[model samples]
Target chain A: MSVLKVAGARKSFDKTQALGGVSLELGAGELLGLLGPNGAGKTTLVRAIAGRVRLDGGTIELFGREITAATNGARAGLGVVPQEIALYPLLTARENLSVWGRLHGVTPGDLAPRITRALDWTALGDRADEPIKRFSGGMKRRLNIACGILHEPRVLLLDEPTVGVDPQSRERIYDMLAELRERGVSLLLTTHQLEEAEAHCQRIVVIDHGKVAAAGTLAELVEATVGAERRVTLTLDRAPDRPLPGFEAGESGVVVRAHVRDVAAEMPGLLGVVRDAGCKVTDVEVRSPSLQSVFIHLTGRELRE
Target chain B: MIPTLLRIAFTTLRRDRVVQMSVFLLPIVFFTIFAAIFRSQTRGVTAGVRAAVVDEDHSEASRRIVAALAEEKGLRVRTAARPEGAPRGAAEVPLDRARALALVKAGDVPVAIVIPAGFGAGFGAFESRAAPIELLSDSSDPVAPQVVSGLLQRIGMTAAPDLFEKLGFSLFERYGGPMTGQQREAMRRWTSSLTDTAPAGPGRAPGRRSAAGDSLSASIVPVRIVDVLGDQKRNPVVALTAAGIAVMFLLFSASSAGGALLDEVESGTLERLLTSRAGMGTILAGKWLYVTLLGVFQVTVMFVWGMAVFQLDLMHHLPGFFIMTFFTAAAAAGFGLVLATLCRTRQQLGGVSTILILSQSAVGGSMFPRFIMSEGLRAIGRFTTFNANALDGYEKVFWREAPLTDLWPQVLVLAILTVVFLAIARALARRWEST
Candidate 1:
């Protein structure tokens, strides 16, 4: 079943268009990634799906139900971990989960085990009772995730939930997503970290300037990468102001280009040709385009810019 | 959904410590300021005034009149050299009717007292029913008229007993009865004292007595000072300040609640709340509920403190006081919501609320007394709800003995003000989420 679908979604704030004609769909048991630079409307799309924002022109559907004007109760099947930590710092992890659960109308009799199970899912069971204020960034992020999913919503939306956490916590979050996938939980995530999306997301949607640039499986995206062609680099003992075939100048050293399917496969022959030019190769490396490379190729600007 | 919204509102209220402290502390702060003002010493009307005694008749009665005016509290008697330029024996130009009026016009003395010619005829007429005493006094200032009137009444009260005694002795003399030895002795004593001690009449040589004994209470009798109104006829300013401070902080509490709204928006707790089955209206309603309750609580605490320390007796007149104060708080909270919604940031809220409070305080009669101001200024004060409901309400409850029924006018004004502000607040709130 489709967990969520957005068709021709548009939203504007003041004079700034935060989301413009964006559309996407997510399936059950899938890890979908919305990738973009800052101000790219990734958070806006997530908020639209979470029902925290109103779409100026479009509709959002969750679990095959038209939820364009869904009341908060109509959204009980959904979970959202917002871009900013929404958990009360003065409240403990357990308390935060209880608040979310109670607000979602979980009965008191069913609350305890639910909280415990949620804690265990996020690896926060040991620290569930500690105040969020006393928690580390990673711990607070984990609690944030736990609070949203405690009621076991069918679809989960996390907006840059791991942005400011340590690498260990990042990996831990990846593992938790995997566990949720095993439990048949559909997840939609927005992140700026391209590699993380490439690693964990089954499908990555690159959004730019408030619209979707690309959406497909990782292999499909990689095959369709904007800087899809690979560049071969030959590092010399010193900066060799030397001529090379199909070469583009780079700041660090000499560079040569080839398609991933073509010249990258002929690296040895290319290296031999360089060798035959009476120059010794200090080091040789083959590089393929990444999602960032794809982004730069599409927008003709650096992702950070 | 309602519970969740209420929880969010209450939680937000509890979380912002600065707003919380202000909301809770405003009433106390105002109470303290007003209490201190009320507890200060009261100054009587006519504490100092210059007057010249012109002795056309040097009768003992005129001297006695001068003596009486000298003994009066708050009158600073200045002896002028002459009634025209200056008096001979008086401290300053002795203020007769015309001179005192001119001095008052020129802003010299608040009031001037003149013992008129034939002044002893009035006293002698009481014994023989022949003539009445006439005194000239400046009545330009409202307070001056009141002071001159009060000083004259005091003299009349003091002289009534002796006049009756002399009249009784005269009556006895006319009856031609075999007078008792004691009665004859009393008549002889009166005659001797009157003949020997009486000044010629009317204006006597100015004496130094009016300066020696007058205390400050004899000044400003018409203007009801806060202190005079508060603790035991506290200085009129004190009572006025207390009432003003109480109402000011009540409005202040409203802004504090408004501030909490900003905190909620900033916290992302509001977002969490909205996404969780709590509609924006539910959240807003809950916030309004909490803030209004807080305002009521703020007023109650202030009144309780006032009653405890200042003996304001909110309980004895509990129904009236509560109804008046509670509605005032509600209206204030409503106005506060408008302030909060219009302001985009907490800092903006701070600036806006301060402006609101100061403006209201100035026009609402908190910072100063409005009665002494001109009719136009007083009319300008009535434009603000704080003045319309507050002064009228306080006057009805604190100064006058009135029941809850009397507070309906104030209540209606405040209620209407509350509704208008709340409507404005609601309209503003819809745009606030985006801001």
Candidate 2:
């Protein structure tokens, strides 16, 4: 059964609309990546789900119960790692985890092991005693994630979880999320990290200007966005003035875009054409579609812009 | 639950050197400034007297009397070579009656006293007449002149016993009769009998007005001050300092509450807390609890320091103090919360909180003591929460030493204010999220 459902969610701040009629269904163990540009209402959707903000016009159901406004029970089911760090700078990581546990009504005996496990999962056991103020930005981000998970809620909402984190820390975080997803913790994460989403998310939804422009698995969305055929690129030293059919000259006469039946079927022919063009033929490469390219094609703007 | 918040607040206070200095150390600095300002009155009101002694009589008695006036503590003596050349009247003497009046206009000395040329002849003639030396005093300066006049009067009145005995002995020697030691003792006793009618009149001399003031200034006789704010007869500085502290705490309470607002909003905990099991009222209650305790702690520290320095009678004034402190703390807390709620970020809170606190403290008599402020300014001060019940309470308890029953007026007003603020705060409460 679908445990959490958000249907036709719309939210606004002042006159600026943040979300418009966005819908999602989370079944057990579903790890969904809510992808969008910087101003794509990703944070807003997360906040709305966590009950930190009231949706302008929408219905949100969690665990088969409708949660129109946030209540302690509804909130108890949600675990959010906010974009901004929320742990007290003056508090040690262990104390920070303890506070969150207590806030969720965890018992001290149960709390210690749970905190230790959360820290261990984040590979932060050695740094648990240090105050967050003493931690590097990457460490703080990990601690921030540890805090959100300490409550062990059924539905986890992460907003840009790997933002501003070092590569090592980012991988550690990705591994932890993978483990949680495998363990049947349903997840809804908002991220601009397209690669991470592409690799980890079971399904993807792209939101733009408060509306869901597209939703599906990466392959489905990519197929839906572009034609079945792939585009191949051939590097040349100079552009041939002679007519090269179905060829578009790219930057500095070095890159060229051409339609192809199959990347493998076209690479040899494309290289021969480049050699015949008398352009200093260089390497040949197949251009596979990325979420970034899909987004740019769909929105006509950069993901961040 | 409460202890956790306290630990957070104090830990933040300890960790933040900026807040520590602003809240705690700044007050000590202001206290030192205030102490120094009041300490200026520690010296007698010594106005310079610009006058010439005629020395026409050339008698030992004339020289003796002239020498006495010259050496007078309140008179900063300047001598003119000749009596005729001496500044003709009060205004010419550096700090004489007319000179003091001009000084009041010119903003120089607030007081002056002139000893006339014939003062010795008059003192010698006191056996036949009631009056002795003529004391021309400048009364333009309200406080200083009265002080100078009183000092001079007491000086002569206290010396009357010896003068009377000397005159009596001179009179008795006109018959050329040999006198025994018994006769001298009898004359001394006879002269002492007129001590009751000495100068400065009726009861005790004006110089001995307050025992606490005696050690500081021998000439300054501290008296009941009729306040410009409410026409209440009280000690000016005592009322002012209490008002200052009261106003200052309003700023502190507001700032403290405002900081909490920023932290919650910034950390996104405010929405989480509201959405949790904790009701809006509970959230507000928790915040108010923290703010009130902070305010009470601040006030207690200040009062303890004040008592250590000024020996304030906090024991007797405890009940009235509690009544005043409670409402003051509550009002400031409400004000601060409103400012915080209106601001989106911590930086905004910082800017707006400063403007509100400083402006209120200025009008409410914190920046400068209310006692020194003008009438219209005092009226403006009355509208502010700091000046409202705080000044009244300080005047009643510290200055006038009124009974608790007599302070019911201030207590009632403060309670009403606390309620008004609380109502406004409750009305403005919105169950909102940041998305």
Candidate 3:
């Protein structure tokens, strides 16, 4: 069963329509990456699902139950880690977790253990008693996620959870998210990190201009946008004496570029052609279409723009 | 570098709304409030002095004197007795001598007058032995007694010219020569008859006017004002000022603390809280609770400090003081929440709250006594939470020794304001729950 489903969610702020009929689904244990350029309604979609932003038109469902007119209680099983660090600076990590846990209706008897486990999960147990202001950025980010998950929600919505974090911290967050996924917690992650999405997410939904531009796996998006083709380049020791067929010499006349339907199928034949052309190859590189290229191709703009 | 720095400074000042308000708008608003207060004070609008009269003699002459004193526009006379059909818990009995003295001691009335026995007869002959009129006054209320004294002198002069003339002749007789027994006995006989009938002729009764003549001596008033409070030390105005300033700043502090809600929104904590099971009502209620408690604590600290430093009579006024404090704090808390919810940002809240609180404080009598303000201004002040109601309640408790029931109007006003402010705050907080 799908853990979360947002169908045709639409919202507007004053003159700007933040979401224009955006729809997506997340199955149990699946990590769905919400990819969009800045101001493309990624946050708006997440906020609508979390019940923070009221939609002008839409229906949101969890586990096949519709919650279109429900209060915060209807979204009780849903966890949200906003883009900004939301924990109180004056409160200790454990105290912050306790507050959020209580707010989510964790009983006092269960709250203490849940807070301890959450702190341990974030690897902040040793420093759980320290104020959040004393924590490093990465530590604060981890605690921010920990606060949302203490109630053990069935679905989690994270908006740019790893922005401005060190590589080590980013990896730690990814691992933590992976652990949550293993426990059948579906996640809808909104991020500007295309490479992170490409590496970690099971599926991607690209939204632009408040509408879904494309949705698929990495290979499928690449195939759909730029076709199933690979760019092959051969670096030679010296300039080729003659041009090879179905190939052209690149800048400085020392490298040759060839586009092929399949790199594995056409690589040997292309090398044979290079050899016949009297080219001594020192190195060869084959590249497939990337998520960045797919994003740029579909959105017609850079991700950060 | 100099030009670049100057440009940056000017640009920042122009761009920042909070800075612009603080620099240009605040001074003008503050100046207007203070100028109004000062101007009203200098104009000397008479908010009447509260006083009571104890007619111990209960004679027509004493009653006339009481009536005359009551006619003064500068005095607001209250009988020692509660009016007939007055509501339960509001019964105040008219002052007898002991009760009048007690009221004076409690500082409830600035002055209380006692018309002793034989005071009526003293109106007939100036040389007659009469009990003096006692003026019991609170040492703290010096100005009210002086005004009362002046009114009494005017009444005495109007009622009795023969009394003064007889006293003058007696003084002259004693200084000029020793009177023979026959002469003294004849003078006494003439003085005795003055009470029953007007003197018949010259030397018929010493210093008496003819029965046929219409004269100022038709009635004699030998009243003398004796100050009952001699060298007593007390200053209730200090307590008034302390309470006024304390209540004013307590409101400002509560509003500033309410700005914490804006901080939460800016930090994304509000959104996080909203996404939880806690609804918008719960979040707002929680904030209101915190602000109210903060207000209570702030005001308590101020009063405690006032008691220590300025000798404020907190202990004597404990019940009324605490009641006023609670209501004032609640109203302030509600006001702060409304202000915070109405503004979009912390800087906006700061600028708006500063203008509002300062204006309220200035007009409300924190900066100046409401008693000295013009009637129109005082009417405006009565609408403010602190100036009109809370500070007045505190003063009544601390300086006037008024009963708890007497403060019902002020309590009702504060309660109403608290409800209104909270309701508005809740409505405005809906903006946070949506986009």
Candidate 4:
């Protein structure tokens, strides 16, 4: 059964329709990535599921129990990490974790062990007693995530969890999430990092203009949007006199590209054409379609735009 | 490059409403409030010195003096009381010495005039060694007593000229042979029609009595100033000053502490907390409680400093002081929360709270004595601003030395205001919950 499910959630802020019937689900022990361009309703859908937002028309179910703003009994099982670093700057890391733990109804007996584990997980054991204001951006981001998971909620919502952090911290955060998944804690995270989503997420849900544009694994998204054709490229020593048949010249006349389903079978023929065109091929390259291309194909815009 | 920098700064300032309000509007607001306060003190309708009058001797001279005092535009004379704790239909009785003294003690009037039993016999007897007229004054307001004393001297000269003339004739006879009956009769006829026209009125001549005028007019009336509170207080003005400054700064710090809510909202912590087990109401109540406790601590520190350095007599008034302090801090915390919730950003809260607290402080007697303000402005401060009631409660504790039970009215008003302010803050805070 799904640990968290939001179906047909609709929300409008003033005249702007922030979420128009967007729906997604987080399965038990699954890591789901919510992908969208800016203002694409990923945060709105997450907020609705986390009970921070009231949906105009929708149902949010956690562990098979319906959750609404008024009926929030199931909310205790949900944890949310906002896009901004929400911890008090002057407070120590342990203090912030303790506060968030208590706020989420963690008992005193369990708070200490949870904070200890969170400190170890974030790799800030020695610096746990220091004020967070003195911490680096990546350290603060790790602690921000630690603050959210102290209560041991079944479903976690992380919005831009790696936003302003270095790559080393990002790797550590994904490792931490992988451990949580190993412990059977389902997670739903929103990110503009398409590469992170492709590498770590068990499933991806792409939302655009307040609606879900595509949802599936990387292979499924690739097949649905840009298809699974690998592109072959040849870098010529000099400019070609005429265009090669069955190949298009790149922006630089010295480079030409062609798409092929099977590179092993098609590369020799492609290389023969380069030679027949009186162009010596200096470098040959073949690459599969990536999530970025799939995202651009689906949204018709870059993720950051 | 300098011109570009200037343009950049100007453009940013123009777009920032908080900067505009702080730079341009706050000064205008403060200037207007201070101008109104000073104007009311000098020439407004409530500029008159409120004096309670007691007439022990109802002789012709005493009655004439009382009449002239009542006619003086600079003095507001109250000669009767409706009887304290009396029924609604109780007949008003003339003010006696005890009632008049009570009025001065209770701060109902700054000063009280007592026309002694033999003041009429000694009227204008330049060297007769007669009993002097008594001016019972509360020393807290140094201005009212002085103003009343000067006006009394002017009234003594202008109100009863015939008595002066009679004494002058007797003195002339005693020194240089008896005056002729013709001369005495002529002087009496000339002084009988003197209508007490001295050009001495409020906001004009007598109101501006200087040191020179005071000395020149000192001999007309043998007046004794009895400071009602000076003898009891170690440092006479310290209590009022401490209370006023303490309450004003209490408001400033409380609002500042309440700005933590805005900070939480801006930092996204509030949204995170809302998703926790605690609801919005719980979060607000926690913040209000924190700010209230902080305010209490802030005021205690101020008063303790006052006691240590300035001899404020805080230890003597502990019970009433604590009671007033708790309620005052609670109300101020609520007021601060209201300001925080009413504005969106810290800058907006800063500009808005500055205008509001300063305006309230000026009109509500924190910056100056409320008794000296015009009656209209006093009423506005009492009705609209929380500072007035809070200060009144403190005065009752420190100045009047009244028991804690006497503070019910001020405490009740502050308690009601605290509830009202919290309600307004909570209502305004709805924007942060589930939006």
Candidate 5:
């Protein structure tokens, strides 16, 4: 069963349409990645689910119960980790956890143990007493996530959780999130890092112009948008003046590229053509269509103009 | 490169609205307020000294003094009062000694002049035992009593100079032996002619060499000064000063504390809080309560310092002081929140709060005594700024030794203001709730 679902979510801000009939769903223990460019409806949808926004026309359901802005109890099971560092800078890491835990309705008797567990999970146990302002960016980011999950929310919404962190920290964060999923906590994450989403997410949803552009697994998206083909490239020691069959020349003319269905079967024939063109092949490479290519195909590679 | 840097600086300044307001608007506002304050005195628009007159001696000499005081442009004398709820054309009852003293105590008039029953019997008897005129005053004004006392002396000398001459001749005949008939007759003729001549008009005596410790002025009127607030209050001015400074700084600290909301908005904590069980109304109430508590603590610290170092009677007035402080802090906190929510950034809040609080302080008797301000500005301060009501309430407690019942007006006004300001702040804060 779906843990959380947003259907036909619509919102408008004066003359600007922020969201237009966008729909998506999160299943039990699933890590769904929401990908979009700037000005997409990802944030608006997240806010609507969090009950901070009054939707113009939409229905958000959690655990098969419909939720609206006035539905205070609906937010009890939901946790939101904002893009910015929402913790107080002057407060200690442990204090921040305690505050957030209390705000999320964690009982006074259970607060201290929960704070201790959160500290250990985020690996901030040793520095929990010091002010968070003295912490490194990666430590702050980890603590930010720990603050949101103190109440053990069943469904979490994270916006750019791993942004502005080093690779090691990013890997640790993904590890922490994986542990949550193992404990049956469903997460719907929004991010600009397509590589991380492609590597970690079970399913991806791309939104453009306040509408859902595509939603499916990596294989399905690639097949529907760009196609299941491997891109091949050849570097030559000299330029070929004549046209090469089934190949396009790059800007330098010393480089050439082509697409193939099976790399093992076409590699030998493609090499024969390079030799026939009187070009000595110095290097060869084969690449599969990735989420980045699929994303670019669905949403064009342009600024938010 | 220099020209490019200059252009960049100009462009930045043009884009910053707070900087523009600070540079251009603040000075103009300050200048206009101060100019009006100073011009009220120099431009001859100063309000006349208000005095309540009670004449128990209804003799010709006492009547002449009252009539002369009424004619003087520098004094507004009230000899009768209409009872409460009376119509505008109702018959005014003559003021007695008790009624006149009530006027001084109630702060209706800063000074009250009472002529004794035997005052006209010995009008100008310089060396004889006679009844002295009594001046009952509320010294908080520091201006009306002195002005009225000096005017009384001048009016006594000018209103009946012939009486003084007649008494001088009688004294000479009694001490220096009887004068000849011809000499006595000539003096009587001269005294009779002196009554026909017009007295010097009530104007400033030109180039009069005045001494600081001149007892001659006091001897002319034979008056006794009575302070209606009594003499037991120690360092009363210190208490008033502390209250003024405390209230002004309380507004500053309250606004600073209220800016924490803006800080949370910038840091995204407010957004996080909104996602919690707490709604927007709950968040605003929390902020208002915190700022009000901070303001109370700030003003209490100031008063405690005054009690320790300046001898302000804080222990005696504890009950009234706390009551006034709570309401004052609540209203000030509301005002602070209003400014914080109205501005978009911390820099903008700083500029706006500074201008508003300073202007309110200047007009609200925090910088100077309200008695010293023109009547128009005082009315504006009382109606527009909460500071005037707050200070007035403190004065009743510390200066007048008033009972708790006297604080209802101030408390009621502050409560209304607190509600209004909080409502405005909440409306302005709707932008941050969503969208």
Candidate 6:
């Protein structure tokens, strides 16, 4: 069963249409990634699901219950971690969680345990009492996510949750999200980090200009956009005088490059052809189609753009 | 480097509307308000005092006294009438002593004059028994009563000669039988010349100028001005300044607290809150409560300090003071929230709030006393949330010792303003939900 369903979500701000007939679904325990360039309606779509933005026209359902508007009861089962660090800098990590937890309708009797569990999950247990201003960027990011998940909502929507964290914090955040997925919590996250999405998300949706551009597994997206091509590069000891089919020389003229439909099937023949042409192969490298290449190919721009 | 720094500064100032307004507009507005006040003070245009006259004696002497009071430029005299069974459109009816005293106590009129029965007949008669004319004043209105008292004293000086001639004839009739036409003429001439002449050198008795000079000045008995309300001596300037500064900072604190909404928006906390079970109303209400409480606390601290350092009478006027403080804070908070909702950015809010709050303070008498402002400016001040109402309410409580009922007008205005501003803020906050 779909844990969260959005259909024909439409919203406009003045003359700019932020969301135009956008639709998506998250299955039970699914980890879905949303990718878009700047001003491409990704945040708008997430906000609509979180009930922060009122849609001009659309329907949103959580666990088969249709949400017609952004009301408190409609958003009761949802959790959202916004792009910016939304925790109060003057408040301690525990205090921030308690405030947000109460706001989310967690009973005071139940709030303490949930706060403790959330703090433990985010690995901020030791620093729970410390003010967020004194925390490292990674710690604050963990606390930010912790604040949203204290109520254990059925669906969680995160917007660039780990924008400027160190590598260690990023990995920790990925691990925490993985654990949440294991616990049967559905997740939809928007991020500019293509590698993170590619590494963790079960499926990905690319949105551009208020509409879904593509939605599928990584391989499916790769096949649809860049056609499963593998980029192969072979560093040579000497330049080859003769040219090979569908291959080009690198800037130094010693590196030979080719885009192969199947790297495993073409590497031996390509190496033999280069050897026959009087070039000595010093190094060989092969790269499979990645989300970055697929994203660029589909959106025709960088994520930051 | 110098040129580079200068360019950067100018660019920043030009780019930021808030900075531009604070730097360019605030001083000009303050200067205008204060200059107008100073000019008014130097020109010495005393504000008119509202008073009522109750003539129990319908004689010519009583009528003359009433006419003299009506003619004073600074006094606005209204005849107090018995409201019982009087026609709705009746221009005048006699007010008894009890009714006149009631008017003074109720603060309907700051001062009430009562001409006792037989006062007119007894005028200038050395032996006739008559009660002294009474000037009943509301102690709560310290300043207006003083003005009324001064006007009465001046009226006495003008009526001295007539009183002296009457006294001379009465004494002559008692001692030497009825005076002939020539004797009466001589007495009138002597009394007129005696009043006209300057006192013969210093230290000579003012009454020694003529045989009846003492009796003459003594015949026009000084009006007995009595303060019906409690006499709590207070410095009006100190009270006004305390209230003004308190109100000014209350607006500032409220606006600062209201600006927290923009901060939350920029920080994304508002979006997170919206995504929670709390609705937009809940969020705005929470902010409103915080700002209101902040203003109350701010004003309390200021007044407490004022009491400690400046001897402000906070303890005696606690009830009126608190009522004014609460309403002022509530209105200020509402104003702040409306301001925040109207602007899209913190910079925009800052520019708008600075222009609005400072202008209101200047025109409303938060920076200067409204008494010194021109009628037009005073009218404008009256419309401001603080000056002609909130601050005025505070001054009345602290300096005038006004009762709760007496402060109802100011309280009503502030309460209405608070409701209106809150409604506007609520409507404007819908923009956030739509975003």
After aligning candidate 3 to the native by TM-score, how far in Å is the CA of A136 from where it should be?
1.1
Give the candidate number with the greatest TM-score.
4
Error of 2 at B219 (Å): 17
CAPRI-style quality class for the chain A–B interface of candidate 6: medium
| DockQ values per model | 0.27, 0.22, 0.63, 0.77, 0.73, 0.65
lDDT of 4 by residue, A160-184 (tens): 9999889999999999999999999
lDDT tens per residue, model 6, A189-232 = 99999999999999999998899999999999999999888899
Arrange candidates by DockQ, highest first: which order? 4, 5, 6, 3, 1, 2
The total number of steric clashes, by the backbone 3 Å criterion, in model 5 comes to: 0
Number of the top-ranking candidate, with DockQ as the measure: 4
Global CA lDDT of candidate 4, please?
0.87
Which residue runs does candidate 3 get wrong by more than 4 Å?
A: A241-245, A248-253, A302-305, B1-4, B48-142, B147-170, B173-242, B304-319, B400-407
Candidate 5 CA-lDDT value: 0.87
How high is the TM-score of chain A in each model?
0.89, 0.90, 0.95, 0.95, 0.95, 0.96
Global lDDT of each model? 0.67, 0.64, 0.79, 0.87, 0.87, 0.79
Q: Per-residue alpha-carbon lDDT of model 4 for B288-398, expressed as tens digits?
A: 899889888888888898899987888998898889989999999999999999999998999889989988998889998987788888899999898899999988888
Q: TM-score for candidate 1, please give it.
A: 0.66
Compute each candidate's TM-score over C-alphas: 0.66, 0.63, 0.83, 0.94, 0.92, 0.84
Off by over 4 Å in 5: A234-256, A271-283, B1-5, B43-45, B56-59, B81-93, B126-131, B175-216
| Docking verdict class for candidate 5 | medium
Give the count of colliding residue pairs in each prediction. Answer: 56, 6, 7, 0, 0, 0
- Model 2: how far residue B366 lies from native, Å: 4.0
Give the per-residue lDDT digits (tens) of candidate 5, residues A97-209.
99999988999999999999889999999999999999999999999999999889999999999999999999999999999999999999999999999999999999988
lDDT of 3 at B53: 90
